[model samples]
Each structure stands twice: as C-alpha cells, then as structure tokens.
Target chain A: MTDEQRRRRGRPRSEQAHDAVLAAARELLAEVGYARLTIEGVAARAGVGKTTIYRWWSSKAELVAEILYRPISIEEIPESGSPRDDLAANIRLIVEPFTDPWYGPALTGARNDLNADPEGQKAFQAQIMSGRRDTGRAVFQRLVDAGDLPPDTDVDYLIDVMSGLLVYRGAIWRQPITEEDVRKLVALLVDGRPPRRTPS
Target chain B: MTDEQRRRRGRPRSEQAHDAVLAAARELLAEVGYARLTIEGVAARAGVGKTTIYRWWSSKAELVAEILYRPISIEEIPESGSPRDDLAANIRLIVEPFTDPWYGPALTGARNDLNADPEGQKAFQAQIMSGRRDTGRAVFQRLVDAGDLPPDTDVDYLIDVMSGLLVYRGAIWRQPITEEDVRKLVALLVDGRPPRRTPS
Candidate 1:
C-alpha cells in the first residue's frame, strides 16, 4: 500500500456513520438547499466532526454525488414484454421519485446546484449520461431487437425524447406526473397518431 | 380615475429607465444568478438609485419576473401552417434563446432560485400557469381548430409534454438544444413512431 493508504489504518470506516452523514446531507439539502448547505452543518447534523466528513469526502459536491449514487440496477428497468409497458414503468419510476414530498425537494435542490457548479455539473453529466444513459439505451435496444421499432429509428433520440419529457414535468412544470400522463405520452409517441382536431 | 391614480402623475415613469433597469437585471442575473442578485446591484449596474428600482418593482423576484416578460410576446409562438412546423418553431424560439451564453446561465440561476424560494415558486406558477399557459393553450387551440390534431387529443397534456422535454434538456441535461433536435422531438411525439430497442 502507498504511504497515504497505510496511514489510513483504523476500524476501516463506520458504515453507520457514513449512512448518518448521507441522511443528514439529504435532510439539510432538502431544508436549506445546496447553495446554503455547508460541511459544518452536515458534520453537526450527523453528530460527527468536520474531519470525519472530510476524511470520507473531500468536498460537499463529492458527498452529495455519493448520496445520489443510489445504484439504479438493471432490474429496475422492467421488461414487461411490451415496449409500451416498459416505457410507462420507466417513466413512472423516474417521475414518482421526484414527486415524493420528502426526497423530491432534496433531489431538485441538488440538481440545481449541479447545474450551477462546474464540478457538480461534470459529476452529474458523468452519472446521468454515462451511467443512466447506458441503462436507458439498453432498454431501447431491446425493443428494437424485438422488431417493435423501425430499423431506421434513432435510439439515442428516442431515449432523449422520453426522458426529456419526464425531466420537463418534474423540473419545469413542477407538477405531479400521473400514470395516466405516462400512458398518454407513450401512446402518442409509440402509436404515432395524427394530430387531433379541436372540439367546437 | 381614482384619486391615487390621478395623483400618480410626476414626470411620468421613464420607459427608458424601466428598460435600462430590466437590461441590467438580466445582465446580472446571467452573471451572478438570482440568489446573489440584489436591488442595490441592479441599481448600481443600471446607474439608478435603489429607490428608483423599488419604485417600479417591489423585489428582485418582481424585477426578474418583469425581465422575463419581454420574451413572452405573441410573435414568439409560431403559426407555420402545419402543427408540426408551428410546434417546432415555437419550441425553437423558447429553447434557442436559452442557449445564448448570457440567457442560459441567467435562466438556470433564476430557475434554481424559483424552485428553492416559496414565494418565487408561487410567482413562477402564476406567470407560467396563468399567463404563459394561456398563450400556449391558445396556440394549440388554434392548431386543433385547423384539424391538425385529433379531436380527442389533450392539448394541456401536449403542452406539458413539450415543455417538459425542453425543461429537461435545458435544466437537467444542460445539453445544447438544436433546431434539428426540436424537429426530431416533434416527429417522435406527433408522428407516432414505435419505440426503438434498448441498447446493450
């Protein structure tokens, strides 16, 4: 081991303390927002010393990034046989979490912070574009392989369009995204219906 | 006119000063963001006193709101004969302005502030839902009347979907939205294409 690694000899690290720190960070993020949240506040809230937090995470952005790394397993992407069903479930899962009263605010606050801070933005891009995008692209590829989609279809654009709609609802409109809404969106996009006439 | 209205005559409010203040506010919002922006900052930048700014707008929220009002003119919504073309154009105008280096950062910061501040959030709802919604709704209504859309289609849902996609792109993805992207999105939603296969 390197000298720095050798110096880190102890009880390794307390998983309990780590969880507490993350929970505290989430709570504070929800309450005060990222711009207002501080390492001291997190340390105090977690009942840990500032050194304890710094030992684990070099910065608040790193801590927040770790907190958001909620391992979106492949199993989370449902393969309900039909592409429409899978898409709807995907939409619901993504949208419902952001609409949850407790976690929603924290996620939104962290998201805003990510957009504003350069380092946070890069972390976010890597996490979503590299990590999440892989999962989404995989799901689309499955449907295309099944011959449900046209051979000429743009998979990346498809993923962007679907996820983009959900992002809009959660972040922009700031409205509740119902399952019915997801169904309509999936139907409208997948079914490719002509524009409807306005009722007189 | 009411007595208060009658006595509200001085040198009459200088439209030039009003425009200059808005310009300064927009510039600072692009530079410092909404949370850091202040009446004092706006006044100093605009070469006006704090009282002058306060006379026109009650708070920074109001000033930012007024500043945003400039881009919401009717002409920004397209009427390009086809719903697809019109929708594409409308989305382009809104999305394109945001891509401007100055406008993008300003909007990102403003959006962050709006979501974080309860009062600012309420103001956003009022402006977007009540004011912008009406304008958005009218345009879609016209599209429906023109028989470009199906009679049973939900325009409100459509608006939410379109806006949600753009919001997601700009606010969350931080991706540069292009006219081509807008067209592809329009085709995906309005053209009823099948879902692509998920990538591995």
Candidate 2:
C-alpha cells in the first residue's frame, strides 16, 4: 500500500471515526434537511470534534457529495432487449430513487448548494450529469436503432426535456411522477401514441 | 389619500429615499448577483440608512421580490385564433425575455434565493407562478377548444412539462431556449408533427 494508505489504515481509531462520521451525516441528513444540516450537528452526533470533520472535509457540500452519490449508477441501466421496457426502466431508475425518504431530502437540498459552487457544479457535471447523459444516449440510440425514434433526433435535447420534467416534478414541485405521466412522456417524446394504441 | 399616504408624500425626502433604494437594489442586483447582494450594500448605494431599507422591505428577498416581477405578465398572452401560431408565440413569451442581459442574471440568481425562502416562495407563487400558470392555461385551453389536442389531455401536466423544460433550460442549466428548441417543444407537447407537417 502507499504510505498515506498505510498510515490511514494503521490507526483503527481514524478508520472507525471516518465510518461514524459518514453514518452520522446520513442519519442527520434524513432527520434535518440539508438547509439545517450543520457540521457541528454531525460532529456532535458522530461524537467527534468539529475540527475532526473539518480536517477531512473543508465544506458541508463536500461532505454531502460523499454521502449523496448517484443512487442509480450507469452500469445499472437495465438493458432488457425490449427497448420499450428498457426505456421505462431507465426513466424509473433516474426518477424513482430521489423519491426515497432518505435520499430525496439530501439530493434536492445539496443540489442548490452544488448549483452555487462552481467547483461543485463541475464535479456534479462530471460525476452525475455525464453518467445521466450517457444513460440517456444509450436509451435514445437503441430507440433509433429499433426504428422507434427518428434517426436524426437530437438526443441531448431530448434527454434534457425528459430529465428536466422528472427532476422538476420530483424535486422542485414535490410531486410524484405517476405511471400515467411516464406513459404520456414516453409517448409524446418517442412516437406520439400510448402503447395500447400501437398495433402489436 | 389615506393619512399615512399623505404623510409619506408630505416628506419629499422619504419618497426620494424609497425610489433611490429600489434603483440601487436593481443596479446592485445586476452588478453582483443575488447571493452577494446585501441590505448594507443597498443602503450605501442609496445613501440611506440600513434601517431605511429594513423599514420598507423586511429582507433582501423581499426587495428582490419587488425587483424581480414577472417579465411576461399573463395578460400579454396572444389570442390570435390560430392555435399553432399562438402556441409558438406563448413559448417565446415565457422563454425569450430571460435571455436578456439584465433580467436573465437577476432572475436566475434570485431563483435560488427564492427557493430557499418560504415567505418569498409564497409571494413568488402568488405573483409569478399564478400568472404563468394562467397564461399556459389560456393557451392550452384554446388548443383544446380548437380540436388540436385530445379531449382528455391533462392540461396541467403538459404545462408542467413545457414550463419545466424551459425553466430548467433557461434558469437552471443556463442555456438559451433557442427557436429550434421552442419548435421541438411545441411539437412534442401539442401534437406529433412539426408546424411544417400541418398544411396551412
């Protein structure tokens, strides 16, 4: 192992403290939304000094970055061969997880902070948005290949519309993206008919 | 006039100070953006006491609320008898002005602040969103009346989709909702075909 890695692992207290801090952050994030979440509260709950949390993470946004990794990673996009089912699955993967009681508050709260931070925005673009875009590209590309979508479709713009709608609904509007909404979104964006209307 | 109004007008200095405070707030908002804007800064720029600003508007958000009134008021929606033409015009009304050098930055910057403020949020909804929703309702209701949309189409959801995409594009993602983008949006939401496909 590298010298820094060896030093970190050599002290059991440091490792235990790290895990405790993460756990405490998660719990408190769920309890108090991101606006009210404080390093002092996390330190108090984690039973570590404020300096301890500060020593590792410079800002609360940074701490939240670690705690709030993407719930649906790129590798998890369901490639179910049937493009329709896969597209619906992809939509669910993006939209459903944020509706979770624990993850939802953390994400929507941190999103505002991340938007204001230039460095955080870049990191989010790289880490979260790039994956999101790629997953969308895959879905759209498959649809094009399957003759379900026009070959000249603007994939990036379409992705923005779909995710923008879902995110705005789930995060800003605080509404559930119902099944009917999903079906309508898919139909409107894809071929303009509900699945039942299309001949088998 | 009411006694308080007569008293306020009686003091010419008070009227000038109010005008100066508002003008200073607008200048500073465009100069430094919402997050960096402060009551002290407004007072200094206006050559008034901080208490003067506090006396008029309770918070920076309240000041911003007055400064950042909706650009496209609901009454401005065109009723040109042509659904397609009117829909495109409606989209332009909602999405275009924010592209201006002055209003775009102020609106986007204050948007984050407004999201975080509950009282500000209420006023924003009452003043801004209600007007916006009404405009969309009018446009879509016309479309339904003209037999362009399905009889049972969910007007509210379509409004959300259109506004969500445009707001997320113009406000959050910091992209211009171009003419082409507007055309694509109108097509997807209203009917399957672009305007070209429908014979005049």
Candidate 3:
C-alpha cells in the first residue's frame, strides 16, 4: 500500500464526525429533551449523514449517556488525601456535572427518557456506574488503609447510601444538597457520633 | 324542573365514569406503562367517551396520580403504638404501594413520565407529597412527644436522609429496601451506635 493510502486509512473522517455528533447531541438534548429527540434530528444538527451517527451510536440513549457522562472519569476523584476531605471533594466533583446549566437540563431530559424503559435504565447505569464505582472503591480502600473507616465497612453499600441520599434529595424532593449536609453525613457515618445539640 | 332531572344534575354520569376511568387507567398503566398510555386508550378500555374523562380530569397525569395515590391518606398509618414500632410500620405501609405488583409498575411509569418535565414533577410532588409529608410529620411529632427523638434532632433533615436512603436504593440502585434494612437504619439513627464488628 502507498504511504498516503496507509496514513489516510489510519486517520479517517470518523474522528471528526464523532466529535461533531457528540457536540450536536449535547446542544440538542438541552433544547428538546429526550422524549422529543430523534437520531435523524441529531444527524442533521451535526451536519453528518444518518449513517454516520448510526455507525457510532446505535441509539439516542447511548449517545446522550456518553454526552452527559464523558467528563466523569475515575481520575477526576483523587484518593491520596485525608479520607473525609477526599470523599467530600470527590462527591463535589461527581455532582458538578449535574449542577452545570448546560449538562443539568440535558441530563434530566435524558434520565427521564432512560428511566421510562427498564432495560435502557439498566444498560445506562452499567455503562456509567461501573467506572464511577471503581473510583469510589479506591477512596474506600484508602480510608481502610489509613484506618479512618472500619476494617470491614461495606464499601459498595456505603457508596450506595451516600449517593442515594444526594440523588433522592435532588431528584425526588428537588432540593439542593448542601455541602454542609455532605460534611455532616460523612462525619456522622465515619465518626458514629451525632453532633452535640446546638441551641435552636 | 323535575325531581329526576335535579337528581341527574346533582349526580351525573361523571360519578360512574370516574370509577371506570380510574380502574381502566390503572390496568392499562400496568399493562403498557406510562410511556405507552393515552387518554383515548383509557377511555376506550373503560367503554366511556373521551368527554367523560376530560370532564372529570383535566389530563392523564392528574388521573394517573389520583388512581395510584388515592389510598395514601394521613390516617391510613395508625399511631397507637410505640414510636419506633409505629415508625417502622408506617414506613413499611408507605412503601407498600411501590412494592405491590399492580401499583408498583404503574407508579414507576408515572414517576418516569413526571420526572422528565420539571413543571409536572413539581405539581405531582406538591399534590402527592403534601399529604404524605403530613403523615411523616405526625410520626415525628409522636416520636418527639414520646422522647424517642432528641429535642434538637433536625427532624426534617433526618427524615430526608431516611427517605433518601430508601429512594436511592429503590429508584437509582433498583435494589429493594428490605424490612431489615429499614429497621437497622431506624435503629442506627436513633441509637447513634455503630455495630460491633466481627473478627475477620
């Protein structure tokens, strides 16, 4: 094969198309919500053929999931610091995307669409939560190594409870989970002590 | 006007149509879920015209909400017993609808639909949770009166944590919040005591 042909084959139009598709998806999701969004619309918005979108993301849910969660990687949460401090920071980072003006509405829309179908919700969680859980596992392991947590503390259950608390408040009650609440929750679970009664 | 005409005016076909509409909606919701349900479908299934449904209910959301949650009145949870036992029982009762085979699927579908639209979610929560919160308020007040909870215990926050834990486990994790889990949570928060660790 010629050198030019080999180079062209290695770096195809797929890369540029991938970025454009994702960008268009993010913008359109914020505007329309998942219920009204269609793959055709996404393709048109991205200035790509429908075949190009289909080549990468098989479905709208898959594309939207990637768009909302692409920024959340295990490395974003550092586990080397004090366990409580690290946990608090890590949680803040995890929630940052959900609080973003652009990402928040899109995610809410995407989530509602995914949630309606049980199968879609399962797949989305498996794809997104697996990496997030690994990060949480690392923090728990660090806490164990530092003797900040009980040796046999169930890491997965603890993570579930912590995140569940935040999500429940945000989604169900539409209430903002304050940093103070996070701090208290972490401290209480770790220390097993209720704060001394403050005069009301 | 004739007495019969006056009686018909006072108690129109809306009375019978209301019951039939709710029943059919509940059945269809479980069968096809909220995403697939439609007013026309429910009306057809109930053997009633669309006008009857529209007259009694402004929208499908209002009708569905009433059908699934009509049973969750404040007095349904009895408060005659000890606070801890009563609280646990009340929690179990509160979750009963979500766990029922018939009602659970419908509520899940309804929730997914409501959660996507911010305005709809707000109205549903306000209309539904207002009464539910009253029941919770009664339970907390009883606990406080009986000295089961500390005077300075942030009741609202505590309740949020408790329900959030359950919801997180149920909605996000898709895990059952078992009776034992509820009991342990209630006990742990009330006692503020960490479990004794078994030697590994």
Candidate 4:
C-alpha cells in the first residue's frame, strides 16, 4: 500500500476497533447481564486485546454506563402548555427508561458495580452526568422562559434534588414513581407547596 | 443427658448459633467487604453449618443489610425546640451512619447485591424499611404536634422523598448532604419555600 494510504489506515482502524468493542460489550451485557459480563469476555468477543478495552473504559461498570447514558434530547420533552405537566413528563421521560424490564435490573446492577470503582464513577460523572445535566438545564430553562418557574430558581440544586429523587426511587427502591409522587415532588420543589391531602 | 436437659439445650444452642452467625457476618464484612463476603465464609467463621446460615438469611445481601440496619432510637434524636432543626438532625442521624468510611462502600455494595435477590429485597423492605418508616413517622408526628409541620402533611410521602434524597446523595452520589442542603430540603418540604440564592 502507498504511504498515504497506510497513514490513513490507522485512524479508521482504531475507530473500527472502538465501535467493535462497544458493540461487543453491549451484546454481551444483554446476553449475560452485568454481573456475569467481564472485560476479558468483551476483549475476546471484540477481537481486541484486553488493554484496548481497558484503555478506553476502566471497568465493566463504566463500559455499561456509557452504553446506558443515552440522554433524552430536547425534542423528546413534550411542549404542553402547563409547565408542571411538562416538568413531570420530562422527569418520567428521563427516568422511565430505567424502569424497562430489560434496562431496570441492568442499570441498577451496573450502578452498584460503579460504587466499587471510584475512578470509573468519576469518569461517569464527568462525561455522562454532565451531559445529562445539560439536558436538564435546557428543560428547566424553557420553564423559566415561559414564566413557569420563578426567575431566581436554583436550577443546579433543583437538578440535583430531582436526580436524587429519580435514582433513589426508580433504581434503588426498584419501584415506579407514581403520578401522584411526581406531582407531589414537582409541586413541593418547584411550586413550593406542602404536600396536601387529596380529598377522597 | 436427661431428656429435660437435652430439650432445653436445643433452644439455647439455636440462639447461640444465631448470635454467632450475625457476629461473624459483621466481622467478615469489615474485613472482606460486601463483594467478597460469602455465606460460606460467615458459616465457617461462626462455626455453624452453611445450612444454618442459609436457614436464617437467604443471601449475603440480607445478612449485610441486617448488620447495617441499626436504627437510631427516638432518644438519639436531639430535643431542639425548633421542629426544623429537629427534623434536619433526625435526617442526619438516620443517614450519616451509612456515610461511615467502613459502612459506605459496603452498604452501597450490598444494596446493589440486593437488587439481584428479590426475595431478600422484599424481606429488607418488609422488615428494615418498614421499621425505618415508623421512626420517620414518629419524628414527623412530633413536628406536627409541636405546631411546626402542618397537621395535614403526608408524613409517608415526606419520608419517601427524604429517603430518596439521602440515598441518592449519600450512597449514590457519594457526597455529604451539606447543612445548607438540609436546610433547603426542610424549608422546602415543610415550610413551602423556593430555594433562595445563598448570599455570595
């Protein structure tokens, strides 16, 4: 091959290896679930060396986190007139994917796995969490622009509390956050209303 | 041995075995952590049969959960006159232990492990979570009775949200819930106030 072609070969070959490793990791994750899946297995399946996988991802948890960090785009959030409905819908949209029969267990399983790997968790927070927060910022900003939330709303803190509620309920508790619960959270956090008893 | 003596021996022997297993499990957890700890190790350490351990606890997760479920008694909650301070203190009392360097990783690790064992999770919920909720109820009720929280407030839902925040922040995010954050949560949940910008 010509020198020019040989030089060009390196970039695409590395890209191909990257895609192959991710695809193999995803497939194996689905096949074996997170507990049984391993870096060695991903390497062997992807036809890459263990170091290649390790170079990109610190552990199976990080690998799985990348696979699961598909953010809900701005377009996905519904444009209902009421901001409360929109906000609650946005929350469900972001969190409900975790409740899927396939994703729920896998997500929680991977989350727990991440706890053991602090470096991987930091990488995940830097990359995946920051991306997720950006999406939250956009959604909350829309509410502010529309005069739904007060101008002085602490969006960052809101994001943190909302995120905590979502993960704590959906992933940790292993239960669906009901519509009433969503309404209560939004009302309390955004509207600053105490949880009122629903008249029987 | 006399028949009466032999019959009496059975009850004390079983009780001793139970105490021994719990002690062994707690010690082993401190040594190996939740991920590497096993029923076999617990049984061997306790000098009990594996079946004996299994008979009492379904999985290592349940055993660890039991070891970690030491609740703060009502007496432990400080009697600060302000209900909000009392409430925040109560929250810290309940959640801060999990943040113990020795307990934090192990608790999160076991929590994830529990996700894989549904029956164990149910037992944890039924026994541990319910007991926790009861404590929360007492605290909230005391607040209401003190003319602090409104009597119409839903304590159960409050408990859930507070719990979500605690686990989400402490265990999941691996961050200390700051005093400011606690004040905000208490004010927002109890007094219905939006998050205000802290003075720069």
Candidate 5:
C-alpha cells in the first residue's frame, strides 16, 4: 500500500533468503546443538551463500540470537485496565518462549554453550538480557505514570524480582508454572501480607 | 566424649585424611575448574591414595558435592520469632555459598559443568535443592502455624519466589546484594498494597 511496497524490487528476494537462513539455522541447532553448529552448515542447508548470512549478522551468535527472537520483542507487554492483569499477561508472554518444550530446550542449549564464549556471552547479555530489562522497565514506568503503581516504587528491583521468580521456576526447577502461581506473584507484588501484631 | 568418639583409633586417621582430601578438592576447584579437575589430581594434592578418595565417594561429581555441602543445610532457616527477620536470614544463608568470591564461583562452575552429567544433576537436586525446599518448608510451616501467614498460603511457590529472586540477582547479574534488598523483598512478601475499591 505504501510507496516502498510498490517500488520494492530486491526486498522479496532478501526476505525469502532471510527466512531460508533462519529455518536452516533452527533445524541445524536443534539437530547438532549450538557448539557444533557452523555458518557454513547453515548456509549450505539453507541453500544460501555464507555472505548472505554475514550481510545481516556479524557472528554466529548474533545470527542465532536473531533467528531465535520473535519479530515482536518482550517490549510489547500486554495491557489491560488493571495493573494485575497487565503484569500477569506480561509474565506469560515473556516466559512462553523459554518454556516451550521443543524451541525452549534448543535455545537453552545454545545459551548454556555460550557460557565459555566471551563473544556469545557479551551478545547475549547486551542483546537479550538488556533488551528484556529495558522493555520491562518501560512497561513498569507506564504503569507508574498511570497511577497503577506507587510513585515511590523501585521499578528496577521490581522487574528483577518478577523475572527472577519466573526464571527460577521455569529454568531451574523445570517445573510447569501454574496460572495460580502467576496470579499470586503479581498479587504479592501489589499487596504484601502484613504480619499480625498483638491484639489492640 | 561419647563412646564412639573415644574408642576409634582408625576413625581419627580417616577423619584427618577426609579433611585433607576435602580441603584439597576445594582448593583445586577454585584454582582450575570443574571440567579440568579429576579425582587423581585431588588425591595427589591431598597426599592420599586414590583408594582413600574412592572409599567414601563413587565419582568426582559426588566427591565435589560432598566436599561443598556443609552439615547445616539451607532448609534449616533461622528463626527470630518474626517472619521478616527469619526470611532475611534465610536469604543470606542460602545465598552465601553462591556469592562468596572464592568458594562460590568454583561451586557454581561445578554446577554448570553438571549440565553434561546426569548423575550430578540428580545428586544436586536430591541432596541440595530438595533439602532447601524441605528446610524452608519446615520454617514456613512454623510461621503459618503461628498465624504469621495465612493458613491457605502456598508455601512451595512462596519459597521458589524468594529463592528465585535472590538467585537471579546474585548468580545471573553478579551484583552486590545489599541488606536493604533482602529486607525489602521480605517486606513485600509480608505486606501487600490494599486493593483499590470503588466509591459507593
């Protein structure tokens, strides 16, 4: 509908090529794990030249991360009238990918493999983790501005607490997180359990 | 002294030898890394026979885990007649080994290495993680029993939330956790904000 769409010539070819490379990368990563994956292998499997891969991404880690991240980042947190609803929805949205049975394990294997690779670690921390925090911070800031959260709230710690709890349950325990768990956590963040004092 | 303490001649030698082996294992795990460390290396460093190392432990992973865990497990959360105090103390105690500049990183590296070792994973979950849950459960049970927390409180999820947040900050961020952070988390768990009500 736009001028770019009407005039675009090489765009479709590039889009098709990008999709091919990503599909190949995903398949190869699942089959061989992250450490064994090579750009050459992905390029060959995707039937695209190695230069096609490098044109978009500088390194293998970058390519893998780019391939893995959804078009919509965690920044697009869902919003409802109430803070509680928005928070719960936000948690599920972010957590869904990491806990996915098939995709999740593959991504985790890639992440664990990055532990020793300084370049991979830097990219992961910079691109993935940093993006997560910034997105969540923006969402929390909106909530605070809308008067849903208190003005005095420490948004940084709050984000850490919420994400940390979710990661702990999902990644470490490998447990199936329940709807009830999410509800209670968001509820706890909003309302604390005041200790009972002596009868007055 | 008890009869067992007084009557054992070989027990004393074995105890001395056990201490030496553990000390050496701890030292090496710090200097090198889990992947490069071996039982034979630990034995030589401890000035003991390989059989001495094998007498009590079955594998290198088991040996490392044993050498690391203190007699007082994390489940033995402290009590101070208050949920706030108890929770703060519990967080510090559990997080101590992970954040220690020397002892902690080595243990963590060993844990990371356990990803490839199914035996090590099981041992860690059963001996360490389970123990943490049980110990914290007993502590929370006391709090609930005393009516500090609501009887319907989900203790299991609560434990996960607390520990998960602490781990996310300490292990992942590698940030310095302050006393204030611990206190605030415990306070949040204790006192939730009252839900807003519509005016009649």
Candidate 6:
C-alpha cells in the first residue's frame, strides 16, 4: 500500500469511539452524577485508553460540560400566524427537555457541580444566561415587530419574567413543564387581569 | 462538689469542640468540595473521636443536610403591608446567607453532594419545593383574602410564576437578587399589560 493509503486506513480514531465516550459520560452523569463520574470509568466504558480520553478533555467536568452543551436554537420559531402558538412553541422547546428524566438528572447534577466550584459556576452562568436572554429577546422582538406588543414595552424586563419563570419551575420546583402550564404563562403575560393597587 | 453541680459545670460536652468540627467541615467543603469531604478530617480538626459525630449523624450527607436545613420564619419576612415589600424581604432573607462568603461555599458543596446521591437529591427537592410553595401560597392567600387579587385568580399558578422567577434568577442566572428586581417581579405579576393577540 502507498504511504498515503496506509496513513488513511486501519483503525481510524473511530467516530464510534467518540460517541461511545460521550454516551457513557452522559449515562454515568445521570446515574452517579457529576461528582462521581471519573475519567477512568468513562475510558473503560468507551473501550478506549485513559490517554485517549485525556487527549480530548482536560477533566471530567470539562468533558461533561461539552457533552451537555446542546445548543437550543430559537431561530426556528414557528410563524403559525398566531402569537399565542408562537409563544407556546418557544416555551415548549425550552422547557420540555428540562423535565425529561435523563436531562433532569444530568442538569441537576451539573448545577450541583457548578455551584460547588466558583469558576465552574461562572462558566455555566455565562453559557446558559446569554442563550436564554437572546431567545427571549428574539420572541419579544418578533411580537413588537408584528405590532402584537407595545413598541415602548420593556422587552428586557419582559424576557426576564418569561425566562425566569421557566428556570424557576425547572430548577427549583422540579415540576414537569406541561403544555397547559406553558399556555397559562403565555395567557398571563399577554392578557391577564388588571393590576392591583399597592397598599400604602 | 455535688453530682448536680458537677453536671452543670465544665462547659457541658465542649461547645468549642462542636464549633471546631463544623468550622473544619465548612472549610474543607470549600477547598475540596463535598465529594471529597471525609469524617476523618473533621474529627482530626475538632480533636474529638469520629464516634462523637457518628453518634449524632449517620453520614456526612446527613450532617451537611442537617447543617443546611433552615426554616424560614414569619419574623424573617418584614411586614411592609405591600406585596412588593414582602416579596423583597423574602428574597433577601433567602439570598443573603446563601451568598455569604463562608456559608455559601459549604452550602454549594452540600448541594453538589446531594445532587450526586438520589436519596439526597429527593430530600433536597422536598425541602426547597415545599418551602417555596408554602411561602408563596401564604403570601398569595393573604393578598387575595385582602381583596388585592381577583377572587377567581389561580393562586397556585401565580405562585409558580413568582417563585419560579426568583428561583431562576438565583439558581440559573446566578445573579444577585436585589430589592429592585423583586419589586419589578411583584409589579409585573400584579399589574403588567396583558399579552397582545396573535393574528388568526
């Protein structure tokens, strides 16, 4: 065989191997949680050497972070011609996975790990906060552009309210984010009853 | 000295020893985290037998859990007559200590450990969820009973919205909860504009 052929052929670092490692990490994170996950265990499960795993990630935390950092895109908002539908879709896309058995455990584990380490916590905050803020901003912007919301409305504040509710429910309450709940949230934000006067 | 006098004398089982153990546990939790904390280390620091701690708590998780489980009382909520003021007070009472330089790290470490263990995670969930829900329900009930909220309003749903926002800010956003933010939340829930209609 030619040198080039020899180099390209035989036991390529297998995309299969890469996927196995990530899958194992994800499973272990759910089962044993972030603190208990080990590089040695991940390597054993993936049938790869510890060196191979180390070559890719510096630590278990970094490996788990990459594995869980699934980018949730908001650009695909359904223009179902109804604002309510659009809002509901957005909420579902964000909140559904948060309640999934796998995702829920993984998320809770990651949060616990992040909170333990200040630096890790900061990284987590930066990654999630920007994405959520941007998505909420996009939703509000669409509403304003479509003349569905007031031009002078505080979009940032509105986004905070909507996103904040989702985060609170998922992280603190541990409640399943149901379709009905999302609908109620949209209704309250859009057409709720009159505000009460503050008592002096 | 008489037996009764002896029983009342000599510092009563050494509060100093108890304080030292807790202090060491707190420090080590910050430095090594909950996953790495050991009873041996705590015993060494406190200059006491490991049996002493074991007599009180079965495991490190239980000890940490006991340390972190604080009941929020009515006196903790400043009676400001306004819902917004009350909300701010509640938020402050919860967040302030969690952000304290010393207490924060230990709490975060314990939280991480709890997340790693399924049983511990369940306990953690029960504590936070029930606590938040009960507090939120009480506040909402007071408001509605006073005629500040509509008679038919869903207190449960409103509690979800309000508490969810606060939890989101604390756990996910990792932002410092301020009086202004709490006030805004109360205002938005109480008086924000209704959602606009989406075109059919």
- Which candidate should be chosen as best, given lDDT against the real structure? 4
Give the chain A TM-score for each candidate.
Answer: 0.71, 0.70, 0.75, 0.71, 0.72, 0.68
Q: Give the alpha carbon lDDT tens digit for every residue of A1-200 in model 2.
A: 99999987788997889889988988887787677889999999999999999777767877886676553554676667877777777887777656656564465456556656767667666775677778788887888899887667777877777888886787666678777777777876777642232223
Arranged by DockQ with the best first, the candidates are 4, 1, 5, 3, 6, 2
Candidate 1 ranges with C-alpha deviation above 4 Å = A1-20, A27-58, A65-69, A102-104, A193-200, B1-14, B29-36, B65-71, B76-78, B194-200
DockQ category of candidate 1: acceptable
Docking category of candidate 3 = acceptable
Candidate 5 chain A, poorest ten consecutive residues by summed lDDT = A191-200
1 or 6, greater by lDDT? 1
Query: How far does residue A105 in candidate 4 sit from its true spot (Å)?
Result: 2.6
Candidate 3 regions exceeding 4 Å error are A1-20, A44-49, A100-109, A115-120, A193-200, B1-21, B40-52, B67-71, B100-120, B193-200
DockQ of each: 0.40, 0.21, 0.31, 0.45, 0.35, 0.25
lDDT of 1: 0.67
lDDT tens digits by residue: candidate 1, B70-179: 44555666576776676776676567555555454555555555655777667656765566567666676666687766657777777776776776676455678866
Model 6 CAPRI rating: acceptable
Stronger candidate by DockQ (1 vs 4): 4
lDDT values, one for every candidate: 0.67, 0.73, 0.69, 0.78, 0.69, 0.65
lDDT of 2 by residue, B4-40 (tens): 9998778888788998998898898778877788999
Residue B26 of model 6, lDDT score: 68
Residue A126 of model 3: what lDDT? 76
Positional deviation of residue B172's Cα in model 2 after best superposition, in angstroms: 1.2
